[model samples]
Target chain A: MKRRLLLVSNSTLHGEGYLQHCQQHIRDFFGEKVTRILFIPYALHDRDAYAKTARQKFQSLGYELDSIHEAPNPVDAVRKAQGIFIGGGNTFRLLKTLYDHNLVSEIKKRVLEDGVPYMGSSAGTNVSTVSICTTNDMPIVCPPTLTAIGLVPFNINPHYLDTDPNSRHMGETREQRIMQYHEEPDTPSVLGLREGSVLLVEGNKATLLGTTNACLFIRGKPATQHEPGADFSFLLTDTN
Target chain B: MKRRLLLVSNSTLHGEGYLQHCQQHIRDFFGEKVTRILFIPYALHDRDAYAKTARQKFQSLGYELDSIHEAPNPVDAVRKAQGIFIGGGNTFRLLKTLYDHNLVSEIKKRVLEDGVPYMGSSAGTNVSTVSICTTNDMPIVCPPTLTAIGLVPFNINPHYLDTDPNSRHMGETREQRIMQYHEEPDTPSVLGLREGSVLLVEGNKATLLGTTNACLFIRGKPATQHEPGADFSFLLTDTN
Candidate 1:
């Protein structure tokens, strides 16, 4: 069994419904084999409400969504899950909750070892990287560590925005922030996934999906943009 | 000696020189009696370059700036400093460096108890609060703790921007992020200091200085905007 993952930059595009933009990709990635998904709604403040919302969305897509918060044993829930979905919210809160519940390793084992299909958007996509260091979410809570489940070789910066040439905002631009991230010693490359973009990975292959271009941040080099449908499997190879 | 502090939202406004917009406020906060200032350039990646740039800026303001990086004894440098300035870059890196050098306590003691006039902008302003939890900077590096020098009762979110009603960007607005910060149990209020705004604290009283209005984020309440020169001293009292 191969490691299958659908890492979306955001759950919804500007005018789309919940996960509407990536619905086809989600269907194709999971296929007809997986009927149920263990939903991790810990990233959100209202876990029950978030789970309820996600459950409706997944059910509309013809899959049963069971929230881990409702499970008596989250670890056992992950162990038995055929597919896993982590919703978007605060990355720090999500990581902290996962660490607090000791579900990090179980989720990793289920996804990587047991070949359970994994899907995440926004905060969910961020935690699938080498570390949540590149996430754009506010650090509302401090996790035990910055280490995350490295489903992918590189870090994912979800909701990556281009520098607005006409804007006078003094806050660091998305590119500038990613450049600053590279300043850290031994930092890995980062994928600036634009809204509506998805990184689909199967075994050792990774492909950039969607209509927009994704920005890539490499250490000691100028950042480059990759168009949709480009092969990003090279990112899996250790750059260090 | 009363504790005097100048917390600026940004170092430079649009098309202005470094610290150009707030130079007058800087001089006013420190006064003519304080000629020599100790500078902390740890927030930036290029510490030496950042220090040199800030040194020139302070010199232009008629004060000698000595970077702590160049000081043989950092703690001693903080102890004997007439004024302290923390230049903005990345808040996490700044706090980490301070914690690594064990300068958090010394700087806190000097600014809070010793009445050595302290000035900070952007990341600098964020750290002068209860914690760096409300900062807008990317977490490039993880500090030992999110705890920062508690110079003020509430946290500061510098370079805070108003939500653009016309914009289609799906990223959370600055206000939304601050509200999410408040979602954490018992989190303090967050002052959304916009660009060109300054928070001037003298002992028990804090005033909102500069030309623009600053937004205040109190838990479970609608965020309110405060005009320039507003009396924000009430923030010092226990809100929880």
Candidate 2:
């Protein structure tokens, strides 16, 4: 069986009781076959809080806990598991730990090469890009050189929403950023995920789940929207 | 005398009567002794269109148009004039032509090496950067390779605006591209300029002229807003 790549996107999981939602994405993507669920217990002020929080959510999904994979070596922790559940926290902290342990290679092996069912929400999607260019976070928490797992060529901007009137941010709204990406490269599509949106990429095909408000940016321009329950697929021959 | 740079940002020159406003900035920055004007007809659609456009705008500026300066040689064009005016049409077109003619190296000598006063609006500013990656045009116009005059390091994204709800664009916001730029390099700040806004880089200073909504990004994160009239001298030293 081919390893499934489930890229979950919901940024509100940082101490917002949103882990339950993250677990649902995991259950929805992978069913009863997921024996043990492992999470990187790194981001919290208290590291142990992540395991307890994730276990509670995992139990809610009607799955018995085989073992909770937690360690400095995310690659090793993930290798021992059948399905990996990466909960959300500050993208910076999680990325910093990943880089320090040099676990990017092993994690990529487990998911892309070894065919381990990989599940991640929020920062999980962020770590798949070449660099963390689209996250709504400051630069203080981690080194700028700390990039993602390079799952796709483009960056993943999770919990994306257009700007509201009261927001005083001078930054370009979510829509504008994707448009700019279209102007940069017209190939690798930038997936703009709203809450509850899931992009499942198996081999070269990517499908949009949840809301269709999600968009795709090719290079530095926006291509078009992927309607809900719609599938987005491209062949390797088309990309090069 | 040091070489001078005039940043005029009017896509539609006389639209908001910003032409006169831009001219005032030119006079203020380059001084009143600018007699002979070297018009870079490079920004116009064709040499014929370039001549006509130059003739019209020169008449509007209250100066007796002595010569059209329609020479394809940017270096020769600079030698024949006391001052220059780089008009706007499509920045990508102007940049492509400059890169194609190998005249960019000569133009750089006139502006950066020599003390010639260089003035450019819209497309002209786009040519000042090392590449035209940040201009406000469709990326459909692809030049084989980008080589700007190196008047500035990072790409200068001019004619920038905040998204309007009524607008019809489905691309990534300009901010998103700038943020993505940070993931690649923590240097090179993306300068978002609105109409009537100008960026004056001299010695080691980049002063903002226009509204207070200008933004700067570093390491894939939004920095702070730079208010107009503030001396942005730090723009020069804040890079690799």
Candidate 3:
């Protein structure tokens, strides 16, 4: 089966230059083929700028943009939709809603089982896990029952980069954090996506996209580094 | 079976205190019960600060801290240790070493089967997971591989907190990054541990240490709210 999981980062969707780069990729991947886009407005509660930019991108591609608030059975919605575009924002809120609406199963089927196009930036991309353990949000509001859509098997930490020396107080670096996770045998694979990097998994092939670097940490194995134009399918694709 | 799973996080060990807070909790849970302490110095590359602090902590607790450099067999070292006190630093680096030494399986047994008093802080805590999806560090170095000790079934993103609205574009907020992982299904549960939080499981009783004011995102369920002193055994404990 063939599926398209495009990991758009907050770095791109929030900035014009990065956003343009992301848009160009989206067009490159799904141009003309995309018909309808489901924009997840959960990330930006009061802000519509992300959604606005996404709409503009779709318009540029000659595809229709949709802001789905309430669906009549979200599973049915995915079955009928062409593209599910999750905007970058707070992924926890989006996952909470998706869990409440019970839309994860269908989305999984469409994306992984049925070859649907699932494009998410930041939180939108982060919410598609068995759990959102790798997120950077605080617990201002914990839901009554927290669950995720579970589109991918491992965790995706987007916008991953090196530590800034200008910061005060020294502690574990980003590389250290992921290494500690690998110290255990049961830890899942970690994908550290830098700005402009994307983990593109289409069917059995996985590609790393962007100008920056991304780190893949798998359990019981050494972490592998990948730069732009690297074949990440070496890590992400399931070879059965 | 009493197991000790070491957890190293990127959080301030004492949540603002100078020394790591593992001492305060040690007397109650481990204390005189601890006999051997195997110091994993892989994370603290050139910086001996964390390792030195770990030795002090164990000694103060009246436990023997065995600091060894050249391990003929890392797996055997862990197998013979009475307790493992993994110090804080960078989890990514420590995990890489663990994978290289083929100690992930032994580490898991130490915690789940052998019942060792495995105590860790900061990055030490992060490595207990199968993956460090929720770590708070910069990607300064590429990990040798991806894999963790697998003490816990879930991927842990330590030092998790929301973004401060007052801040400008600096680092990617914890929430923004973890949400990307939540969007996956096959990924395990994510425990976003703020400083002083411990997901301790004794016997069949699993309780989350530290603050209960956490956001738990599981697959197929809505995001749930957790408060300090809440009964999480129902949600987090192993009933099986």
Candidate 4:
């Protein structure tokens, strides 16, 4: 079976309710096929509270959500999950937890071989890519490695923002950070997803969806932008 | 001999020339006893250009700065240097280069045991701490470990910014990031150094210096703000 993923830039937009803007897209992506989702709330500290919020949201969208933290056997939970949803928080913490529970390979097997539907928001989106090198989160915790699920051919930088020319902050901008990643040898391409942006992938076809355009970055080349309805299928096959 | 360090939050302030904002502090930290300084320009991509920028700045301050990358023997140069300066860039790239060149322990010994004066800006400041877990830079590359020089007992979050109430960005604020760091077990205290802020440590004495205030985040405790002249000496020995 082919891989399927819905990578969201953020959980909520400014002044919007949680997942409100992307509710329709979420519904359409999961459809009637997935009546339940295995939620991974490891990115956040308060697992109970994080799960509660996500459970309510998914419930309202006509799906049952079960947090992996509450599971007696997380690997078994992934194996039985019809869908997987990873929430946003600190990427390091989430990835570390996944390793601690030995769920990386199990989840990968389910998503890749069984084609279990997968959806990730922010830190969640980050872990589905080649590596978590492009995440904007602090490395609050250290994982054994920077490797991720490799659900996508390239890395995903969620919550990507454009440089504010008038601002005086001296830190590297989002684009500059991605540029630095490109400097490393054999680094894969990176997709910069702006607020309210989502990338939907089904088999070999990938589409950019939501309110904003996505920035595609390749090594030795300037970054290019894609519109909401743009086809990103080429990204799945292009290794260079 | 006392461990001497000047950890700056940034290399340059808004609308200022390189190191112009902290030139006086650099002078006071090095003093007349230190005539030449060894420069580590590994944080950035262009070693030659980074070295030139640092060399000229240190020269204007009456110190001869030699780029370690250009030295015949990098570790030997570190052993002979009166002062060490690590310029700011991507923290991951900087730490990886240090490990690749086998300079971590060498520099740590020169500063902690030999009492050689150490100055770091941005990425440099992040690496001088216990770990790079609190840095704001993207993880563009992977180092062997997030372990740093441990010159101080705590982590340093350089270029830390306060949340803007007017902004709508949903990403975690600098305080939130450090808070997450505090959530990790056995994690050290984190100092959030705003742009134009500097942390000066001479032996057991650590002081907050420069134009901005520094925020201290201790586990399970509310973060406290310190003024420019505030003494942070307790941070040198406090493990809790």
Candidate 5:
């Protein structure tokens, strides 16, 4: 069995409903086989509320959503889960919760070893990378370590924005921040996925899916913009 | 001895030279009696170049700036330093470097116990607080911990900006991010220091200094706006 993952840049675009933009993709990716999804709502502040909202959305798509937080044994839940869905919120809080529950390894086993379908958005998408080092969210809490799921070879910077040339903000731009990340020799290549963008990976192959182009950050090189539907599988082979 | 600190929100304002906006404040904070100052340039990607540029700026201000990276013993340098200046780049990098060199405690002792005049801008200002929990910079590197110098009682969110009402960006506003931070019970009140603003501390007293108003975020309460000359000493006493 090959590993399958759908990593989205954001849950919703500007003025869009929760998971509205990616509903069709969600359906197409899972097909008619995946009926139940083990929903990880740890990224959100209100887990119950987040789970309820996600349940409504997933059910409307003709699927059952079971929140991992409500499970008696989260690790066992992952082991038994056919599909996994991680929502977006605060990356630090999400990663910390995952570590606290000791679900990191179990989720990896289910996704990488058992070949269960894995899907994540925003903070969820960020944790699937080599580390949470590229996340844009505030570090409200310190996780045991920055090391994450490493489901993908490269890091994903979700909701990646282009620099506003006319803006007066003095803070480092998104590109400049990624450049700084590359400054550390140990850091891997980063994919700056624009809003509405999704990276679909199956086995060793990955493809960019969306209307807009995604920015790729290679160490010591200029960022290259890849059009939607471009084959990004090359990134999967260039591991740190 | 009373602790003295001048924490500027940013190193440079738009169209301003390096340390240009806060040069007078820097000079006033460290009187003419303090000529030689130890500089921490670890926040930046290029430490040597950052140190050289900072040296020229400090020289123009009639002071000799020595980078801690060049010191044979960084801990000893901090112990003997009359004044300390930390420049801005990335808060995570700054805090990690401080921990790597084991200089956090030494610098805290010099500034809090010995009353050495301490000044920092942007990322530097963020680390002077209880933790680097409210920084706007990307998490380019994972430090051993999020714990910082704890020189100030409350956390500082430097280069804080007001939300642009007309913008189409769907990302969380600065205020919203801080609110998410407060959702965590252990999180402290955040001071949203706008660009060009500075927070001055002497002993137990703290004052907001600059042309613009600063925003204060208290858990379970509405964010309050404080004028430039407002007394913020109360925040100094509300330690986590």
Candidate 6:
């Protein structure tokens, strides 16, 4: 597998500007090799505004960004693109638009076959995994299926949060929700990517990037946490 | 419609025991006429343990509770049920189990046609609405469809949370989510039921019960808050 992927937990940290926290990682990942990035703004509602935000951010990093929504031919755009970046919003709407535009396989081919560097944040990150089953977004719109572009073999729970002991809300915590996901048969292990974290995959080797720790939830096993710079390459071959 | 439903926002309050906050509402909804309550423990994984907890709670309220999982014939149990109560857990798991058992239409018949008293908490309350699209749950499992019991014309977002002004989390707030839900074509209005809140529908009249306020999110209109005693009967007839 010759895949170069950057799966970010979130685009913005608490008080920071858009893509401020992960600026260095993005810069180093793209470098001078990839000059232009085709941006998928389908996850968000306003494509123009989302594209503008991403363009301004990428411009500061010495790269050009083109939104797929404005392209005459989306599939052609993916085929000729040097890199891909999908920003985050509602996952269902994103997946549905991807299907509507018929760009899932094209994007997969560009990354997996052509070795195009791929970057996704939040919902964009969620759709890059095995399935969107572990996403925390609401099903505001029904997509044809929860099946996503399987750039990675395992599922990802992005923007993963720790249970607040002080919270009085009765909704299931992030940990409990992932535990429930494991109850379903044939489900893959989930990587809980906390905010400020990124899972960078270069070929078969995957490394955990950022300041916080990432959690791994395997079926019939207790959820365990791993610190930054941890090797998650086993996730590529281990589907269980 | 002769439906008598109690759709609670949550089973347990922040600091209270299970079903403790809505004890009086549950009791008055059934009264002396309905002595037995049929419990659906499918939302949770451990049927036996969920049944035991519900049995103990209803027993203290002077009603005998029988879990449907223990019934010789689950559909038959619904036919003879004097009242129905569904406990909350994962909404996806609950809907999938309901489809597996082919109990969607049967439960609908018991509630709408026979006027069997129905009560639901959290996920239970979500399934009782138009669809489980507004539920604040992870899609751990895939159901055949998102279409639910439709005991109410509109959808209900249980465990509806107000934005925490103090929190640093970047995840979408409850308001932004429902606004996204409204983006879909022909989607019904959504009622955001706060913790310690219950929406009681008796015959044609729907009353907001409990101490906290319920919010109505109508498409294109701003979200508005309603008091505890406010009549939501219009929600039934006005499906727009």
Best by lDDT: 6
The reply for model 5, stretches above 4 Å from the true place, is none
Evaluated at residue A10, the lDDT of candidate 1 is: 92
Please provide, for model 5 over B1-240, each residue's C-alpha lDDT reduced to its tens digit, 9 standing for 90 to 100.
Answer: 479999999888889899898889888999889989999999998989999999999999999999999999999999889899998998999999999999998888888888998998999998888999999988888888898998987899998999999977777788889999999996778999999899999998899998779999988889999999989988887764
Give the TM-score comparing model 3 with the true structure, all chains together.
0.54
lDDT (Cα, tens digit) per residue for candidate 6, span B152-212: 8899999999999998999899999998888778889999999989999998999999989
Model 4 lDDT, residue A82, Cα: 93
Off by over 4 Å in 3: A11-18, A47-50, A70-73, A129-131, A139-148, A165-167, A237-240, B1-240
Sorted by lDDT, highest first, which candidate order results? 6, 4, 5, 1, 3, 2
| Clashing residue pairs, backbone N/CA/C < 3 A, model 1 | none
**Which pairs clash in the backbone of model 6?**
none
Q: Candidate 4 — what's its lDDT?
A: 0.92
lDDT by residue (tens digit), candidate 1, A53-80: 8999889989999999999998888888
Q: How much lDDT does each candidate structure score? A: 0.89, 0.60, 0.63, 0.92, 0.91, 0.93
Measured against the true two-chain complex, the DockQ scores of the candidates, in the order shown, are 0.80, 0.05, 0.07, 0.88, 0.81, 0.79
TM-score comparison, 2 vs 5, better candidate: 5
The DockQ score of candidate 5 comes to 0.81
Query: Looking at candidate 5, what is the lDDT of residue A129?
Result: 88
Model 4 alpha-carbon drift over 4 Å, by segment: none
Query: How far out, in Å, is residue B13 in model 3?
Result: 11
Candidates 3 and 5 compared: the better one by DockQ is: 5
Ranking by DockQ: 4, 5, 1, 6, 3, 2
What TM value does the first chain of each candidate achieve?
0.98, 0.81, 0.85, 0.98, 0.98, 0.99
Q: What lDDT is reached at residue A144 by model 6?
A: 83
Chain B, model 5, TM-score against the native? 0.98
Each candidate's interface RMSD (Å, one decimal) is 0.8, 11.2, 10.0, 0.8, 0.9, 1.0
Could you tell me which 10 consecutive residues in candidate 2 chain A have the lowest summed lDDT? A137-146
Off by over 4 Å in 2: A13-23, A30-108, A120-192, A202-206, A215-226, A233-240, B1-3, B7-23, B27-110, B118-196, B201-208, B211-228, B231-240
